[model samples]
Target: MSAAKIGDINLYEILGVEFEAEQADIRKAYRKKALECHPDKNPDNPKAAELFHELSRALEILTDISARSAYDKVLKAKKAAEVRTKQLDSKRQKLKADLEQREKDASYIQSYSTVPKTDEEVLQEQIERLRREGSKLLEEEQRLMREQLVRTMLEHQYAQAKTSCDSSAHRIKLKWKAEKDKSNGGYSYEDLTIFLKKYGEITALVMSKKMGSALVEFKTLEAAEMALTYEKGRLQNPLHLEWVSVPGVKVANETRGSILDYEDLVMRKLRQAEERQRLIAQMLAEDEAEG
Candidate 1:
């Protein structure tokens, strides 16, 4: 085997080591050489300047795991090529011997001979077989490549989502409270309308006299944060402010139900009507007793 040629003073030579040297040895070598060839110490020598640059490159590769792995692959391929050359020589010798033996036996054929398929037919069969094998291999390779691409995309998305969540500056929570006026019956639709006009938008209003509360969602954490801040001490007559951030606000209905439902307002009006009727009935009973 010919000795490996060294040309153009490269990183390995600048570090005074073989290409396959361990990282620790590379580092030690770099430190020694960097001190010796540092431009400040070797100001008069152009060669020292070149050597310093080469040492820098060597240290960069040695310190980086990925760069070192890539360089190692190159060395492995070179070694594999040498092994393949020896194997090819052995294969050629065996094939030559087999052909010679076949040629000698060619003359011992039987007199009764049957016609074989034409060369073109044999060639066509071989071509078809190869085509089928190639097609299967291509499909398998394509599937694997697609799977790798999908995994890469998912990793990218997860990284982006993580970054966004980490950088968020504010957090907001929603709170709900239910209030009733038994004397007036139920709450008024007019009051809710006036509230929504004053407030940005109503997120949700569910009315079952048994349960009355609004579920409001904000577009941004900042907006929600602001709303919770400003509305803390504010009160409208007959309605006081009580806020808490609780979980279990159904997200899907926030979009759909908000558009369709006016039930909360309607129920409030019904309750108020019931309260008014009760008061009127009581007054009439008192008047009849006096008469």
Candidate 2:
């Protein structure tokens, strides 16, 4: 006996007998099936003649020993081919599953190797990460502090220079330092008078053509001081202004020096601030270690 074929019709099935049935059994099965399918017996049935014809052919093939032998060999070969195809498909699926499992194992091992093995090691990694973040934040804070301090100092200096006056100076004059390369085209005497007149009435204007410098005497001391404030405001690198040298000039308390040593002061303050933070951090770390 065998399982039924899925696609093509089997001769044994047409005769309504098992594959291993004897010739007598096959003939008995065919006789019974033929009676039910004969055109005369099943008149008005459209497929009655077709079914009877197929049964007759199956009986003819199975009764002849040579024909049955040939047909059995062909059926067996087809079954063998189907079995080999199924086996190949199963092997391909197994190979794919094995490959996927190996890749999964390799990835797991790689990731597992990077993980800290001990609780202490994991704690240390976390501490190191926190330390790096803290240091970055501290550095950024210092940078912002430095910029703010510098800006504040510049503003203070400008304010003092704008208001303070040296009453004892022989002349209320300001010296303009104009670098040769800075002058787009040399500034004219008329240009200086027009520009300086805004700060105060200019009593005298003298230009040193060779040196590319100018000296202006204001009508009042307040205007000269106001003009001096611009020294820190906009007249930077190539252009600068300072009080003209006077032997017994009365320097105001706030505007004693031409330039302040603000950079050194700012640096010292920053260093002290950093030292305090460092000590605090050290104490925290020591407490953590004790805990």
Candidate 3:
């Protein structure tokens, strides 16, 4: 018989016999059906051809005792395996549902057990902690300031003699010479402007193109003396000042006049400030749109 014909029909049902029926009973049932549904008797009916083929295959297999017994055993094993698979699938589904329920219960318990802190409470706690830390920092800063003041007083006392005014003109020049000798004269006029801003006011200043030496005058002798005493020996570039007793010499020019124009620098700074404000406004607009 054809493989498709065998594949399409349940052989036991085609024979009209139980799966456990004897070979004789199977043969009897198949003969009766084969005669009833014979293609030769119903040549005009197309379905009679299919039923005849089924009956023939069923009779052929069932009539053979060995083939019938082997087929019965295979069918029994297949059915048993299908039942076992269904039981295993049921167990798996039940276990999965139980695990999911346990996880959900655990999540619910965790959510309810701890109440979330409010934004205000959290912010207040952070603020108080920061305040405590700031107070500690302030105490440390005050202590450091006191210590620094005491150290500065001691250094000032030690270096006091170098800054004293002398009676002899030659001795005063020698003192200025000694202070000048201690510095490295490599800094530009721009460097002096920064130094003056920090240390003392420059009352009168002059820079000569030929000598390249800067002459700076301070408001008081003490201010000039302080600059000569403290900054003279400390700077790598020699920034020295001689105590000229001349009068009516107030107008002075900066050494690097091209680089230190007040108008040009102020304009550049204002332009930068405007550009920064424009960028900040653009960022705020983007944030508002997103919100």
Clashing pairs in 2: none
Alpha-carbon TM-score of each model against the true structure? 0.26, 0.28, 0.28
Flag regions of model 3 displaced more than 4 Å: 1-9, 88-291
lDDT of 1 by residue, 261-288 (tens): 3233223333543543453455445434
- Candidates in order have lDDT scores of 0.45, 0.54, 0.48
Clashing pairs in 3: 184-238
User: For model 3, how does the per-residue alpha-carbon lDDT over 1-291 read when each residue is reduced to its tens digit?
Assistant: 333223334678777788778766865676567556766557899999898766665565555544445445445555664676577777786786688699768766776567564332343443344344443432443355445444444444323422221111111110122223324244445656566545555544433222324445454445665665666532433445554343222112211233224333334334543543454455445535643
Candidate 2, residue 9: how far the Cα is off, in Å:
2.7
Model 2, C-alpha of 132: deviation from truth (Å): 99
Off by over 4 Å in 2: 1-7, 90-291
Q: How far is candidate 1 from the true structure (C-alpha RMSD, Å)?
A: 24.0
Model 2's alpha-carbon lDDT is 0.54
- Superposed by TM-score, candidate 1 places the C-alpha of residue 178 at a distance from the truth, in angstroms, of 6.6
Task: Please tell me which model should have the higher lDDT, number 2 or number 3.
Answer: 2
